[model samples]
Structures are given as structure tokens and as C-alpha cells.
Target: MTTCGDGRLTCDEETIDTIRERVLSDVSARAPFDAVTGNEDRVSDGAVSGDARATKTDREVAVSVTSLSKRFGDGADAVTAVDDVSFDAETGSIVGLLGPNGAGKTTLIKSVLGMVLPDEGTVEIRGIDVYDRPREAYTHVDAMLEGARNDYWRLTVRENLRYFATISGVDPDSVRDRHDRLLAQLGLAEKADVPVRDLSRGMKQKVSLASVLAGGATVVFLDEPTLGLDIESSRTLQRELRRLVEEEDLTVILSSHDMDVVETVCDRVLIMSAGKIIADDTVDSLLRETGLHCVQITSTDLDAQIVSTLRGQFDTFSANAREAGYQIEVTTDSDGLYALLALLRTSDVTLGRVRTVEPDLEDVFVDLTAGDRTPGER
Candidate 1:
């Protein structure tokens, strides 16, 4: 699916990947961030980690939100977007904020950035209270909000980068070097002279990222940065993001609906719903705690007896039939799929196959936020 707005095209999963392949085949960004094309060596597994280690001493807290709460209207119309949310992101780490639509993810970010003042609570950027010192707080933080409305459509990609770098206070002598480096890194070097209006959505997004980076702020906030990007473009941004965190010692707060990106990029994740922080833990920690417990069984056919047996053994289960066989799903603890296969064999049923299901971040998100009332209700 594709949606067009303000001359920008937002693509869904399949189409986005197809478009990305075409773009990379023609206009490569640069080495580190564009390795998806062919330069695999430049894609470092710990680029962000390396960057973070280099700036460990700079160790200043990047952003902190303590007991923050935001409410709109009153009585029947009341809506709380952030409910006493509090968290601290170190100077050199990538933290992801995740939630379903209307889950208060945007509200929390906006309050922290001083775009909307919370009814109660405080947001501090680099130790500067956003409410008390909005300007001062903003000075230490740079953000690429959804779609990042910063590009000069009339200017060429190169000219726009240079202009933003200059506005960001880059020294005139260093502007060209910085612009060229960014253009090459983001794969816009060849299109340096192409007007922004002519660029694809992914290209425009890269430009947005470059603009925020040019600011040299200690903390960067990216809301849904990969929402409409193809798999490869998303991967490239993740690599460069890690580079920034590991090498530049930059603190990044990313709010996105992309679980794959969150799983691969963030050091920790905060799950939000109904304006509250429901879960916060490292990616590994969440996985470990959740455990790998899924049951899979394939048989020539499933009888009502088997359905009853499965329902008795697990909280939830599903069954479906296809050409190969009938597939059954069940909740299990961290155990191999062999156990279920054994059960089928012992039952004297014609067992077709079995497999274990691995849990991903999306499962974690759905499980964690399942309790909240719909955001629309709030």
C-alpha cells in the first residue's frame, strides 16, 4: 500500500523493499550507511557500541523525564497522553519508545521537546529543564520528528545540506567538508545538485537525518524514522545510527512502530500505552523474561479430542488445515518442538511435522499493552 501526502509517497513493506532496490541500484549513499548495496565490510555489528565506548567519559545524562504527565480538555473529553513517565537515557545509547497508535508515544516525545507542555511533570534535556529553559533545553537536543519538515524543496540536496549545516552553526570552512561527508555517507553525493522536490521519500528521509546530525546536539530524537522505508534503507539507517551512538557518543531516543528496527537497533525499549510506561527493559532482558515457549504440531487431521487436549494444556491455541496437514498452536514453556511431536506420535496420529516458534519484539509489545483500554477511548 502507498499513501501520498505533501508530494511524499509512503510505502508499505513489500513495495518499499522493491523501491529501495531500485534506488540503491542507481544512487548509492556511501560506504558505511550504504553497504546494503555491496560494501558489506563497512557494516559493523558494534558501530554504535564502539561509538558509545569512546565517549564514556563525556557521560553527561542526555535526556530525563521525571513523573511527566499530560492531560487534555476536562471530564468527558479528558485525555492523558503521558502518565507519570520517567526514564533516563545515558549520553551514548539508543533507546526505543514503542507503542500502538494513540498510545501516547507522540505525546511523551512532544512534551519532552517542549512542543506541548505537560500538565504535570518535567522534561529535562541535558540537565536543562525544558519547562524552565525551553531554549536552553532545545539547544542540547536535535530531533527528526515524523517526516521531518525541514527540507528546502527549492534547493538542491547539496545546497540544502550546506544551508542546514551553516544554520546549525558549523564553521564556514568546515561546512563543505561536513556536507560532503554527509552526502557521501547518506548516498546523496551523486544527487548533490538534484532539487529536494525531485528526491524519493527515502532520500528525503535521509536528508532529514543529515540535517539533525548537522546540529551537533548531544541527544537526537527520531519518531518513526523507518516507518515507510524499505528493508535495506532501514538497515542502512540502523547502521549509521549505531555509528553515531558508538563513535559520536550521541544519545538517541527513537519512537517507532517497526519492531524489527527496535529489536536490532535499541539498547533498551520502553513500551507505552494509555500514556503510561508499561514496560522498560533491555531487548535481551525482555526476551529472556518472556521465554521461548511455543508449541507447534502438524498432523494428517485434528480431531475434537486433540483440540480439547490442547486447550486444556495451554491458555491459548489455534488450529488450521492445509494441503500438508492440520497445524495446531499451543502455549508452552521454553522447550523444544520435539515434545509436541512425541505427543502426536504416541497418540498413534499421523504426524506430519513440528517446529518451535520464536518470540519477537512485536509479540512482546502486544502482550505488554494488551491490558490498556483502546487509545481512542482515552
Candidate 2:
């Protein structure tokens, strides 16, 4: 039960009553519960009461950002990191925050976490206004931001877990259970007694992830989690992340430059460039919208001359060769494919094989962000 900025009193108990009053007051209002109240007896008594459920489904938005903007400095020196970005993350889903380097993905994440103040607009976490109640609103969120990684070098892995759990006010018994589970899952069981300063980069990442999840917050934010990890460690992290989402019903907001990770992990994506969210949709939807795909061609004699000729024919052509043969990849339409084959034949370049590579979320991101170049771009 709480009161909003409008000074209207609302409670979980009187929610239905409030709805009823508002509905009856509207010209478009047609009470379906009329049969139960006997207001309209045109319906039969044996029929299901109008008090039956509403036809529309409930929309429970977990994260909502409206017209959010962030700027650094003043006047001509000011730089905008986020500009009027608006979107919502539905409950129990993973949303990816993606963009080119310096595209303001990190800025937006920090803004939502209350690390940086927005110049305009609102950020709401689980129905609580972050600007109005910073501490209270963030009580529902746990974020793993860059440069926030500070592990006690003197403490053992187990000791570090215990310390963070206590600081977060979680029960000791719960911490023990969670710590053990995370240790086994993250392959840190053997390193529990070892000092954190002795751990590898990948091991530190695992520990950080465990600590953030232990916060028991409904929403979790991860930034470039797989950036420095080897293939095996990255795979393990992805597997555990999927398990957490399915079993714990955790909602994740991921910011990463790894396209493969974003494609495989996220349900939806937000593409930003120059402080603005230019595109927002499901990963598959973005792929469909761009119609971007790739074609891979293998050749026996992939000489520099052949590569240069191919590059000239197709704007997106690239080639890689090894001891066996040369591999060429081109991104274009079907008609362009025919033109590519004709050029190869005319150039006398031997083709070993050809295959079409399905476009993933990364292709959509690159295609969209390529046109928007930022000053001092990375």
C-alpha cells in the first residue's frame, strides 16, 4: 500500500474496488461483473458471472525508462552519453544492452544503477522511482559494473563470500547454502581456501558473479562478462547463467561487446548509438528487420590478387586463408551472390566450396551502428 506523486491512495486490498469505480465512471465502461451484482439481468443466472476475469492480460513491467538522458560537462564542452532513451523490460526475461564501443551502453547501465545522474527523464525499477528514492529503489537491483570490482586480496574465496553475504544482510544459513552451490557450479570449490589475490582473471569473474547473484535482487546487471575469458570458461558461465534464469526466475540486463554471447543469451536487445536507442526488439526480430546474412566461399588458390579482386566486387567481402585453401565471406543479396560467382569465374579463382551463414544478432547491431559515428570513436 502506497501513495503516488498524484496524492492518490492505493493499496493491494482496494485495487479491485478502485478499478471498479474508475470503470463505472468512464463512458466506454461496460461492467462484465454486472451478472454477479444483478445490475444487468439480460444474462442468464446459470451462465458464468460477469465477475469473471477481465479479457485483457496483466502487464507487469519490471524495468521502465522514459525519456532518460545523461550528459557530462556544460555548454559546448558537454557530452551526452544517453539521450531520451525509453523502453521497458518485461519480468523474467534477459534483455541485452548492445552497441559499438563508446556508444553509451555503459553510461545507460550506470544511470539505471544510480551511479550517474540523468539530465532528464525518469528511471523506474520495479515500480519505484529511482530518482525519488535512490536507496530504496535500488534495493531491488544488483549490478556488476566495470571498475566496481574490488575483491579483498587478503581474504580466501569462502571468507569473501561470507563477508559480502553478511554485508548484504542475507541470513547466514542461506549464505552457506548459496555459497556452496555457487562454488560447485563455478568450479571454485577447490579454490575456496585460497586467497583471492592468487586467483586468475576468469576465477575472479566467477566470484564476482556469485557475489552479485547472492544479493537476491530481482534484477541483475552484467557488463562485458565474457570479455577476457577463454572459450571453456565462457561456455561454463553461459550455461550457469541460463540455469539461473530458468530455475530462479531472475531477470537479467546484459551489456556486452561479444555478439555471440548476446545472440545466444538474450531474449531481447536494445541497440544504442551516440547516446540514443536507435532500435529495440527481440534478437530474431532485429535480424529479420535488417535482412543481413553472410556467404562463405572456399578457394584452393586464395592469392592476394584474387582477394583484392573479390573485395572490389563486393563492398562487404573479406577473406581468410590457411595451409589448405582460402576462405572468403561476403555479405550481400542473392543477386549479388550470382555476381560474385561470375566474378570469381572470370578472375580464374578456383572455388572449393560455398555456404550461407545465417545472420545473428551481431550482424544486426553492426549494420545499424555502422552509420552513426561518434567523435573519438573506438
Candidate that would win on TM-score: 2
Q: Relative to the unseen true structure, what is the C-alpha lDDT of residue 205 in candidate 1, on a scale of 0 to 100?
A: 86
- Residues 231-301 of candidate 2 have per-residue lDDT tens digits of 98788888888887665556789988888888888888999998889888888888877866688988886
lDDT of candidate 1 over 1-378, digit per residue (tens):
655877776767578557645643333222233121221221222122233233577676778889999898899988777788899998889999988777888878888888887888877776678787676566557788867467776566765665554444333234356567667777778888887888998888888887777645568899778766677877888888898788767899998877899999999999988888888999989977875466577777667676677666544467886675578876554453455556666777885676767767776676677566574522
TM-score of each: 0.75, 0.76
| TM-score attained by model 2 | 0.76
Local distance difference test scores for all models: 0.71, 0.72
C-alpha lDDT of candidate 1 relative to the true structure: 0.71
Q: Candidate 1's error at 315, in angstroms?
A: 10
> Stretches of candidate 2 above 4 Å error?
1-59, 299-303, 312-316, 322-325, 333-352, 375-378
